[model samples]
Target: MDGNQRETIHKIEKLLVERGLRARTIGSTDFPNVSPMKAVEQLMRQCSGAVILGFPQTVIHQGISKPNTQQEKNITDKQLPTPWNQIEASMAFMIGIPLLIIRQQGIEGGIFDIGTTGHYIHTFNLDNYDWIREPSFLQPFNEWYREVLVNNN
Candidate 1:
């Protein structure tokens, strides 16, 4: 996770914990030796819900060369990592896990356009990657996740 995403994850963990909900990270204390894909599978098998911080940040997985596809030529701007996180999102949907995307606030802050539709989520990161006592954007987010994770509604 990038620095911003790390902070975001910590905040989410804190929020979830405050509500008496447990939170798990991909690595750090657990699954430190596993591949991200494997960790994803492991988490999916365990957690009933997932949250993706789709903050337009890209984390490129080295050593995996892109195969020759028609779309390869279309992506002229190779700076941004291809949306690899979408795989987890798709898997969450397939597994019937509730999923949401946390984005930044402002014009560029929102759900990513992955070319297909399924109500891809977008919620503001009112913390703005800093420590805030009362992040305004988090209220709606808390409500949504509380329903999904706690109430199962």
Candidate 2:
């Protein structure tokens, strides 16, 4: 996760704790942007599932040191993601970890359709594990976690 998603994720963690689950926020920031992969590796070894809060695809631009031209539609600059959310998510999936995709408003929700063929693939072979956090985010997770993930293991 990037800096923009940190606050929202913290809120999500609060909700998880409210539902009687132990949660931790791990990312590159914790290691000062040097150890996200190491953290993910350790987490893959330790954690049961992952909660990926997906945001709408958007670009960010900041701290530009250039003059804008009218021909460029008054655009000055744009920011690009460094760690890349999809790569991390893909890693968690390929490692066979249970995933709880919490998509923001207007995004589709379900198991990810991976690769060019776009065949639907369940990360942990669990349906009913992801959804949009509109009415409530805890129900599907609580049910799936208790029944499928926890009881199975």
Candidate 3:
């Protein structure tokens, strides 16, 4: 992973810890066969919830170009060999739906799964099975969680 991606993961992990959620980092630079689902299951067993934030390459093999105004045009013009976005989006949806169902059934704690792929931010609300694109949505949710789940009776 690049420096910027590493920094982002670090910051996210810190935030999870501050919010009273147990966080773990599980990835291998050597083994190319690592499955993210396995890590998620392990973390879920140990913590109330788990947040998985991985690089685009981990989920999408295609390389994204540097930020540019004309980038959208360039991307649309090309015939991508693989639909990485669609695949990752589908996987996220699948994972989140089950979590939401469980949460609605009165699960002890909720899950917040977020990822940054290229320039897009993808978030899944395990409590509702809602997919949110804006990162700012987390701010209000976090505040509510602290006030209601953590601080109040």
TM-scores, each model vs. reference? 0.59, 0.50, 0.37
Steric clash pairs (candidate 3): none
Better of 1 and 3 by lDDT: 1
Taking the tens digit of each residue's C-alpha lDDT, what string does model 2 give over 42-76? Answer: 65556666666556455444443344754444333
For residue 123, give model 1's deviation from the true position in Å.
4.7
lDDT of 3 at 37: 57
**10-129 per-residue lDDT for model 3 (tens digits):** 555565567665444344322224476554344334433223332333232344545555663322222221232344334544443211111112111112222322222333233332
How would the candidate models be sorted by lDDT, starting from the highest?
A: 1, 2, 3
Evaluated against the true structure, the overall lDDT of model 3 is 0.36
TM-score of model 2 relative to the true fold? 0.50
**Candidate ordering by TM-score (highest first):** 1, 2, 3
41-96, model 1: which lDDT tens digit per residue?
77776776776655544434343334575444332322232254666667776777
Candidate 2 or 1, higher lDDT? 1
Model 1 segments more than 4 A misplaced: 32-35, 56-82, 105-111, 114-120, 123-136, 150-153
Model 3 alpha-carbon drift over 4 Å, by segment: 27-40, 58-137, 140-153
TM-score leader: 1
Q: What TM-score would candidate 1 get against the native?
A: 0.59
Relative to the true structure, how large is the alpha-carbon lDDT of every model?
A: 0.57, 0.50, 0.36
